[model samples]
Structure formats: structure tokens, C-alpha cells
Target: MLDPQRTISALRELQRRTGDAQGAQRVAYTAPWHAARGFLTAQLAELPVTVDTDPAGNLWATLPGASDQELWIGGHLDSVPNGGWLDGCLNVFAGLEVLRRLSEQYDGRPPVTVRLVDWADEEGRFGHSLYGSSAVSGHLDPQRAATLTDREGVTMRDALAGIGVDLQHALKAGTQRQKAVAYIELHIEQGPVLERQNLPLGAVLGTCGVERHRVTVTGRAAHAGSTPMDARQDALLVLGRLSQAVYAWTAAHGGVSTIGSVTTTPGIPTSVVETCTFTLDQRHLDPAGLAALWDHAQRDLAQFSADAGCTFAVSPLFQIEPVPFHPALIGACEQAILDVTPQAARLPSGPLHDAAEVARAGIPTVMLFVQSLGGLSHNAAEDTLDAHLDLSVRALDRLAERTITWIRAAERHGARIPAAP
Candidate 1:
């Protein structure tokens, strides 16, 4: 039988063993992460599944079934430095419990194969997020990834070598998905939407598209005491104006924007700022909306810089289109949530997950979100109510059952599975 308490206990045990006063230290490529993976391996040893590590360092535990078609449940085990306890590990442990129940119910053979994946380095400790998932999905560029390094100046190549992963061979991990038909994940909302609505769980609509850029404005520096305020060309002034315009435009368009960092040259207090650089991150659930947001930012930067008599440039840092989940799987998730609560809420994920990469790989994918307390994540204070956590596990199990039924029906009727939008 499925046991939510058992899942919760496992989570608590992992936290006690791997976490510390500062927070979870399960950062990938570190001793704590190795211990966490070892612990997960020990948990799987009790099951009938076979386990292995893919070429990209993703861990897979597979339970053979009557059919070869696979239904994937996945999450990451790695955390940011001093990160929250539940951010990534909850999905894995909860899925582990669900796997245990299915094993018992099916006498070790399900209707279709079920696989649980613990994706490696989803936290991007080296600045590249979705490492393992992207590799398995054939989206990672080995040459580019080889250039990445952590704060300690250890190359991603060297770090992976420590774990027996050769960056050059990572793309071969794509073969692991040869029989995968659908993927589902459970995660914390990492935001305040559900809690604010007094809800315990939500069905994720999709992951938002992101437009990340670095904007730099240039002006001639002058002595602060000698330059008149109105006559001076201050790059900082242009940056400030651009930042305000971003907020206003995104607010009107129902999107979100952040001016995450700002740097001004000529640091001395007595000097007029000659150059300023800032990062702008804009996100929207709709592709058109994301494009419009980017357009607005460009126009604002041009207008603000011209008005201030400063020249400006924008360098693209990263971009990804919105990834909408498979409609059928989304319906299954909604139904599952409704099993636990009176109503099921739907929302778009502003944050990315392994499901995004899997969906982008043309595999049907969906995600379930449990409420996060205080809209907190990536921090020690991140938490969810115990009741909500239990509900989340039950809901995820329900989703798995529904997905299995859907997959079987699709096969029976020869129905074409839908892909991510």
C-alpha cells in the first residue's frame, strides 16, 4: 500500500543526515551530494527495480512491466549551497514511495514499465542549469558545457571526471529515453500563489519562457562637483529609467521582470558615472507575451538612453520559449489534485524544471506543485506544511495511476500522444 508517512519519514531522515544548521549542503559534485545519492541508492535496494547511472550522471531505477513503453517520474537530488531541504529531494522520495506501492500492487510487474529518474546537477552549481536532463534530451552542447566552471575554478569536465562521467559521451545518454512515452514530476511551487489562494496543491500549466539579457549604457564621465546635474550624461540615470519602465510595462502586460543586478563605473563618490551595466530577466507563460516584453524593454532602453544622451548595447545571455505541458497529462494531474482537495488550482511555473527539458524532447510531460510556505525556495527557510506535503504525495500517486491508465488506453486505441507546445 502507498504510505505518505513513509515518504515523509524518508525525507526527514535524509535531511537529518545531509542537512546542517546553515541548510542543505547537497550541492552537486560535493561530498554531501555523493552521500545523498548513496542514501537514495540504499532506499532503492529494497525494491525489485534495477538501477544504473546514465552517461550524463543521471540515476535511473527501473521496474519492468508487461510492456516496454516507459512512464518516467523524475526530479533532482542536488541543491544550491545552503539550500532548502525539500526543493529537489521531495519529488524523488515521494516518487520512491509511489514506486513501492506499484511494486506491491502489481507483484513486481506493472501494466507498462515505470522508471524513476534522479537527474544530476539540476541546481546548476556551475551556472548551467538542467545539466543531466538536457543531456538525456540531447539539448546540451558538450563544447559549451565543457567551458563551464564552478566558483572554485574546477572545470565541469574535471568535476564530471571525478564521478566517471565523460562530457564528450554525455549525449549518448539520450538512448535511455528510447522507450519513454511520458514524463511527470512533483515539485514545490517555489512561489506564493497557492498559499495566497489558500490551496494545498496545483497542476502546473507549463514552464514560462525567459528572456535574459545584459544591458550596458555608456556616457562621458566628469567630476561630480564640476558637472551640472542637468548637463551631465549619467549612464546610471538611463539605467534607472529603463528599470522603472520595465516594471511598468510588465505590470500592464501581466508578466514579470527583474533588474537583478546593477554596476556603475567610476566608483568614487566624487566622479560622475560614465558607464552602467545591469541584467534584465523577463518571463511570461505565453510566447507572444514574452516577445512583447522583450520588445518593450528594447524600446525603453533606446528611449531612456537617447534621452540621457548615452549610448546603449544589449547582449543576450539566455533564452527559452514557454513550454506547455501535454494536455492529457495536465488533465490527469488536475484530477489527481481534485482527489486530495475540494478543488484543483492551475498555474504556470515561473521556475524551470527537468520536465521542461523532457517536454522539449517531444515527450509528453506534466508537473504537480505543492505549496511552499512564504513563497520561499533556494534558502534554508523554505518549507511546506506537513499536511500539504502528505497531500502532495497522495496526489502524485493518484496522478501516476491516472497516467498509467491513460497510456494503456492510448495504446489500446492507437491514439497519438500529444507533445509539448
Candidate 2:
């Protein structure tokens, strides 16, 4: 039988082994991350499954069934520096428990194959998130990935070499999905929405599209004490205005935006800023809304810079369109959540996940979200109530069963997997 307590115990054990007072240290390509993976492998030892790591470093544990078509459950084991305990590993351990139950019930053979994937580097310790899943979906560019470096100046190439993962062969990981028909993931909501609504679990609608850019404004530097306010062409002033405008514009467009970083050229407080640079990150579930947000930012930047007698430039850093989950799979998730709780809220994921990459690969995909305490993540303080965690495991198991049924029905009727709505 499926045991939520065992899954919780496993999570606690992993946290005790891999986490410190500072927080979880399972950053990708690190010793702690390897230990976490090893811990998961040990857990799978009691099950009847084949385990292996792909060229891109994604770990797969497969339980063979009568049919070759695969239903995939996945999450990452890697976390950001000082990340929360339940951020990534919860999905893995929960899926592990479900796998145990299925193995015992089916005598290790079910109607279709089930694979649990622990995607490598989903936290992007080297500045590239979804590294493993993207590679498996054929969306990762090896050449560009090789050029990325961490704070220690170690290139992504060298880091992959340390783990015996050849960057050049990473794209071949896509072959692992040859028989995959659908994918599902369980994750912490990492936001305040569910908690604020007094809810325990939510069915994720989809991952939001993102527009990331770096904006730089240049102006003449002058002595702060000498230059009159009217005479000063302060780039910082323009940047500050632009930052406020971004937030206002995003709010008006029903999206979200952040000025995550800022820097000024002048080192001393005595000098008027000559140049300022900042990063703007915008997100929306709708593609048109996202585009409108960016358009507003551009217009505001031009006006603000012109008014300040400064020159401004924008450089695109990254972008991805909104990814909607498969409608049928989403319905399955909602039904599963409803089975465990009185209410099932459907919400878009402002943060990205491996499911988005899988969905983009043309595989049907959906995600379940457990509430996070204090709306926290990527920090030591992030947490969720144990009761909620237990509920999430049960819900995820139900989702798995529903997805299996859906897949079999599709196969029987010769119906193609429905696309995302």
C-alpha cells in the first residue's frame, strides 16, 4: 500500500543527511547533490526497477510494465545555494513511494511502463535552469551551455566533466523520451496564494512565460555637491523611474515584474551616477499579456531616458513563451486534488519547472502544487505543514492512477495525445 508517512520520513532523512543549519546544500554538480542522488538510489534498491543516469546527468528509475508506452513522474534533486528542504526532493520521494506501491500491487508489471526521473541541475547552479530536462527535450544548446560559468570561475564544461557528463553528447538525452506519452510532477507552490486562500493543494494550470532583459542608461558624471539638481543628468534617476514604471505597468497588465539587480558606475557617494544598469524580469500566463508588458517597458525606458538627457539600451537576456499544460492531463490533476480535499484551486505557475520543458517537447504534461509556508522558497525558512505534505502525496498518487487510465484509453481508441489548450 502507498505510505505517505514513509515518504515524509524519507524526506526528513534526506534533509538530515544533506542539509545543514544554513539550509540545503544540494547545489548541482556538488558533493552534497551527489550524496542526495545516492540516497535516492538506496531508496530505490528495495523496488523492482532499473536505474541509470543519462548523458545529461538526469537520473531515471524505470518499472517495466506490459506496454512500452511510458508515463513519467519527475522533479529535480538539486537546489539553489541555501535552498529549502522540500523545494525539489519532495516530488522525488513522493514518486518513490508511489512506485513502491505500484510495484507491490502489480508484481512489478503494470499496464504501461512508469519512469521516475530526477532531472539534473534544475536549480541552475551555473545560471542555466532546467539544464537536464531542457537537454532531454532537445531545447538546450551545448555550445552556449559550455560557455556558462559559476561564481568560482569553473566553466560548465569542466563541471560536467567532473561528473563524467560530456557536454557534447548531452543532446542525445532526448532519446530517453522516445516512448514517453505523458509527464506529471509534484512541487511546492513556493508562493503565498494557496496559503492565503487557506488551501492545501492546487492543480497547476501552466508555467508562465518570462521576459528577462538588462537595461543600461548612460549620462555624464558630475560632482554631487557642485552639480545643481536641475543641471545634473543622473542616470540613476532615470533607472529608478524605469523601475517604478515597470511595476506599475506590470500591475496594470495583470502580470508581475521585478527589478532584481542594480548597479551604478560611480563608486563614491560624492559623485553623480554616470551610468546605471538593472535587470528586469517580467512574467505572465498569457503570451499577449507578456508581450504587452515588454512593450510598455520599452516605451517607458525611452521616455524616461529622454527626459533625463540620458541614452538607454536594452539587451535581451532570456525569454520563453507561456507553456499551457495538456487539458486532459490538467483535468486529471484537478480530479485527483478534489479526491483528497474539498476544494482544488487551479493556478498558473509564476515559476518554471521541468514540466514546462517536457510539455514543450510535445509530451502531455501537468503539475500538482503543495502549499508553501510563508510563501517562501530558495531559503532555509521555506516549509509546509506535514498534513499538507501527506495530502499532496495522496493526491499525486491519484493523479498517477488517473493518468495511467487516460493513457490506456487513448491507446485503445487510437486517439492522439491532446495538445495544451
Candidate 3:
């Protein structure tokens, strides 16, 4: 029942509306994002679902069922600057396809309610990522949300109000917790793992725990021409050494660590750098492992910096505990993949997603991944083949169908729902 032609046609229209030479520019709280939201609203106009927006700007289209129990499926529509077309938006539109197909199959109402969502600000361009999902999950810190400012010194609170969302109301929205049984999302692998294995689809095991830090190295500035290599304390050199160490750490260990951005104060060609700052994004599947890695990184990097006559400072940005998918949900997803395709692979996601927040909120959560063409994402060149995308969409539709059956069966027996891991 998954219509590839309809889905692909919708994708073409989205790309035409929101896409540009630089790829998708649908950043949250921006004009393009608002336009894209309007487009989505138009698409849902003919459906039986009731569409509404939360205080945090999350868009929801709810279709009633015979029972009050609900299943939420969604992903963010916002993207990083020059991000790929399919990174976050694929799950959302694909969810719409599932809803459309389900609507055509049922008579008056389906056995279980379904809500398709488009979470806001999963890219975290303002301050923190997963803003909308975090608010929905009741994990948002009011103090933090109240003070977050964007590049132009505009507070997130004002930005939300500009789009008709109140911060206080947003916080309150989490209290109206519907009977959401599970949250499912489909995403591109954004890495080469599935492609290397020649797999079209993979069921996500869980989202990785993350530790983000801003590291600064300070050293005495010296004249580049006058100071000898042994005599000069170069902050840039110290930063280079520390970066290499971090790379080695992740290489030897079984995780991923990245320094995506760097800045140097007094970055003059004729002068030794006085200060250098860089960001660290560390990911691991286990909390214990992530903790150990952080502890060792701080201690070892400090010594490494000191050996180069520089002082090292690390400012913690955020820490997300590892979240594993519920066993029942994982099994359902795996079975759905098998039913749709000849083979399926199991993998853990290194990138954080909105599903992580839903899992934290105690709703069972799982994800599906389509293969990326070359492990590229968050860039204009990021992409996946149409065949791969179509296959993943079909698998997700099958998963949703299976999940409906599971939820209805559980409701029938008055079975106790299992807690999320």
C-alpha cells in the first residue's frame, strides 16, 4: 500500500518549494520553515485528521481511532544550514504517506489513533537541539528556554512568540499527555555503514549518549619570527596535539568523537596564537563507557596541554544519557523490515534524534534507517538513491501497520505496557 509514485511526487514538490541550490534551508523560526509548514498543512487539508500546533511550534495531525490510545510518528522538518533534503524531513512526509494509506484502508476509524508530528528545531540552530521534542517530553528547562538567544541576540522566547507560541504555554503543553503508546521515526543512516554492508534498510537499536564540550587552550603569544619552536608556547600547536589525542582515543575505542569547529584568537600569520577553542562531540552507546571516556579525556588532555606549556579548559555544553529502544518495539520494527525486504540489518544510531527525547518521556521508541549514498549528511551534497528511499518508506509503512495490530491486541487483553529502557 506504500505508494512510491505519490511519495516521490510529494518529495519533488517539497524540493521545489523549499529546496535551493544549497539544498534545504528550512531552518526553524525562519521564513522558509514557515512556508514549508504551510505546505504541509495544505497537504493535510483533505485528510480526516485534525491539525494543530503546540506552544513549542510542533505540528500535529491527529486521526481518531475506535479507542483513545495513540501512536505518534514523526521527525523534524527543520534543517541545519545547507542541510540535505532528506535528513529530517523524510520521516515526516513518509509518516504522512503511512497515514494516507491507513486512512484509505479503514472504514470509519482505525483500531488505534495515529498522530503525525513535525517537531521543531531538531537542528538546534538557536541553542540546544531537540527543542520541540524536549518540550513535549517535559524535559525542557524553563530557565534555559527563557534565555536562549540566536546569532543576532534574539531570545528564543521572542522568536516563539513571533510565530504565536508562548514559552509558558509550551511548557504547559507537556502536561496534556495523551495515551501515546509508542513513537516511531525513519531517518537516513547519514553514514556509510548500511551502504558498505549493501543493506537498503536497517532497524535502529537506539540513539547514542552524547557529551558536548567547548575546549579552550591558552598560551603566551610570541613573535613567530623571533621565538624558536622549543621556546614558544603556541596555543594552536597545543590544540592540534589535543585534537590528535582525541582522534586516537576514538580510533582505539569503539565510539565516535569529532571536533567540528575551531577558532583561534589573534589568528595572525606573523604571530603565535594566544588562545584556541574547539568543540568536541563525543558519542557512545553505554553510559558507563561515555562517562569513562569523558573522565579520561579531561584528565589526559589537560596533561597533554600542560606539557605544551598551555592551560586547558573544558566547558560542558550538554550530556544526553544513552537511550535504548524497547525490546517489543525493536522486535516489531525488525519483523516489519523482514516482511518488507529480503534482509535487514540491526544498527545503533550515532546521531541524536527526536526519538531520544520521546524515549526519555517513557514512550516506547524505535527508528528505521535508509542507506545514505556516501555517508554524507548535514551538507548540500548529502543524499540517498531514490530506490533506497522508496524501500525504507515501504518498510516504515509496514512497521506502522504491525504496530497498530500490536497496540490493538494489547488493548484487547488489558495487558500491562512495558516501560521504556
Maximum-TM-score candidate? 3
**Worst ten in a row by lDDT for model 1:** 412-421
Assess the local accuracy of residue 169 in candidate 3 as a C-alpha lDDT between 0 and 100: 73
Q: Any residue pairs clashing in model 3, and if so which?
A: none
Please give, for residues 1-421, the per-residue lDDT of candidate 3 as tens digits.
Answer: 5585676677668777887998888888898898888888898987899998887789999988887888889988888888888888899889989888888888637788899999989988765778888898998886767787766788888888899888877766685356898789999999999999999999999999999887898998888899999997788887677677887777767688888778897888989999998878889998877887787688877787788888888876667899998788888888888887898899999999999999998988899999998999998898888888888888898889888887877776786364321
Overall lDDT per candidate, in order of appearance: 0.90, 0.90, 0.84
lDDT of 3: 0.84
**TM agreement with the true structure for every prediction:** 0.90, 0.93, 0.94
Model 3, poorest ten-residue lDDT window? 412-421
Candidate 2 wrongly placed segments (more than 4 Å)? 220-233, 266-271, 415-421
* Residue 137, candidate 2: alpha-carbon lDDT: 93
Q: What is the C-alpha lDDT profile of model 2 across 96-182, one tens digit per residue? A: 988998898899997889999999999777667789999999999899889877768899899999999999999999999899999
- For residues 211-243, write the lDDT of model 1, one tens digit per residue: 888788998799999899999999999987876
The order by descending TM-score is 3, 2, 1
Clashes of 3: 0
